[model samples]
Target: MDATLFSLYFSALVAVYLLPGPDMALVVATGASRGVRMALVTSLGIALSRGMHVFMSGLGLAALMAAHPVLLDVVRWGGAAYLLFLAWQVLRADMRVDTTQGAEGSAASGFTRGLLTNLLNPKALMFCGLFLPQFVAPERGPVLLQFVWLGAILVAVGFAFDAIYAVLAARLSRRVRSASPFRKWLLPTVFVLLAGRLVAS
Candidate 1:
């Protein structure tokens, strides 16, 4: 593995993960309703998903996808469409009591959603595709292994640190449950903003 690339990827992941974004919001939402366990599970899902993205990008899948102009267009549009759909769902979140046992259904879906979101994310593919090549050297132990290690670490660290964010968000969700006036406006607006971000990107 390339030590330098690993270090670079680690640092970049830390900076980017800490930024407020869809991933963070998802952590907050899951943690708020399902407790820390659920939040962690969701985080794991997201982490694994990111790993998949790195794998695909590093293994030439991303380039191959990009090679076919029609396929690239499909993926791009598909990702955008999914993001917009998620944005609407987030925006329309019910401020009323989360009376349902979300835990019953949230586990797999949370993980899957996290995974699929990253898999479909064009930004991730593009970033890794472009950035990874810069640090990769022929002397590296194994280029593929190096990429995997870098990507895996990035996701794992993200998972571990996100717990803190999830705890805070869950607490906030609890506190705000009774304040529909705040939730109705805040949550939906954030979703709309996230949607806009997806489109803009």
Candidate 2:
């Protein structure tokens, strides 16, 4: 097993999770108004959707790399470019928390929303395709297995961290309402750093 590769994947995953995104914000907002049960259900749906993405990416990447090995560089460069683009968007974005859309809904509805929200985002598929391939080494065993392992780690980590965010948002709804400007810039900075890391790696 490639411990070093796994470490890099883990670090990247953590950085990405830390950045403010629509999905995270939605989970937090849901938790704040709807409570833990819905938040968890929503998170489960999100996690499942991510798992589907990773599985599809694994299959597609493994096949493509097997046929066109040089495409590895393409995935790497593409991922880096995408990360840079995201960083630019974040940097230029207005960081305002919208807390007005957290109506209490059924667990099934929350799950469906979360699933559709993730599956509908083409960026998520692009992200998995780009990011997962970076850690795969042809010298290792089946590339598909490697992808599954790495993607599983990513999903597990993201779920845990997002769950914590849900609980915090729920417990501190009032404080979250009056959130400081620190988060606004902090997440953008993190995105910039992540983009740099993607390039440097």
Candidate 3:
């Protein structure tokens, strides 16, 4: 990749990554409640999912779906439903797990959860197919090689920002530990927004 093109793409991607999202929230929440080590592990999970998406994109799965309009619509709608399901799950669960009040629930394997969550998002797969072409120059090198490099670049950038978010959330959530009621109300809102985005697009 050309240095100038890589810088431009990197800047745009960083801007997008900085925006609020579930992945970021989870990282922050997990880190605050657990620790940085757990948060870093979760970031690795998200990166693994990104790697899988890159593999899928290279196989032409993303592009081939674009050729079939009906299939694309089905994917879009199905993704919307999944997002809503996630939203519902968030709403139904008790947000606050009081570590101070009682024995905490068993520690979740956050890394695996993060990886599975990202891999399952069809919109993310579509975005990968769409976003990469803007920065890639076929003449720069072999197409697959370029694709792999760009995917790695994006994942690295995203991982760094997610860690930052984790630290910030950890710092902020410390004053209040018994706000599960509020968190319960707040977290579902994100999933609902994600679902709306899917439906609107």
* Pairs that clash in candidate 3: 96-180
TM-score-better candidate, 1 vs 2: 1
lDDT tens digits, residues 1-201, model 3?
A: 667877899898888897876577667766665556566777888888888888788787888877876777776777667657766865665554446544323234456656765766666777788888777677777888888888998889888988887677666666577854454555456556756766777
- RMSD (Cα, Å) for all candidates, in order, is 3.5, 8.8, 4.1
lDDT of 1 by residue, 59-121 (tens): 787787677766666766676677567657755555433448465465665676567666666
Candidate 1, run of 10 with poorest lDDT: 183-192
Model 2 spans with C-alpha error above 4 angstroms: 61-105, 174-201
Work out the TM-score per prediction.
Answer: 0.75, 0.64, 0.73
Error of 1 at 196 (Å): 3.1
Q: Which residues of candidate 3, in runs, are more than 4 Å off?
A: 25-41, 87-109, 176-181
The weakest ten consecutive residues by lDDT in model 2 span 96-105
Measured by TM-score, how close is model 3 to the native structure? 0.73
Best by lDDT: 3
Task: Please provide, for model 2 over 54-107, each residue's C-alpha lDDT reduced to its tens digit, 9 standing for 90 to 100.
Answer: 997776744565467456456555655654554575457444322453444356
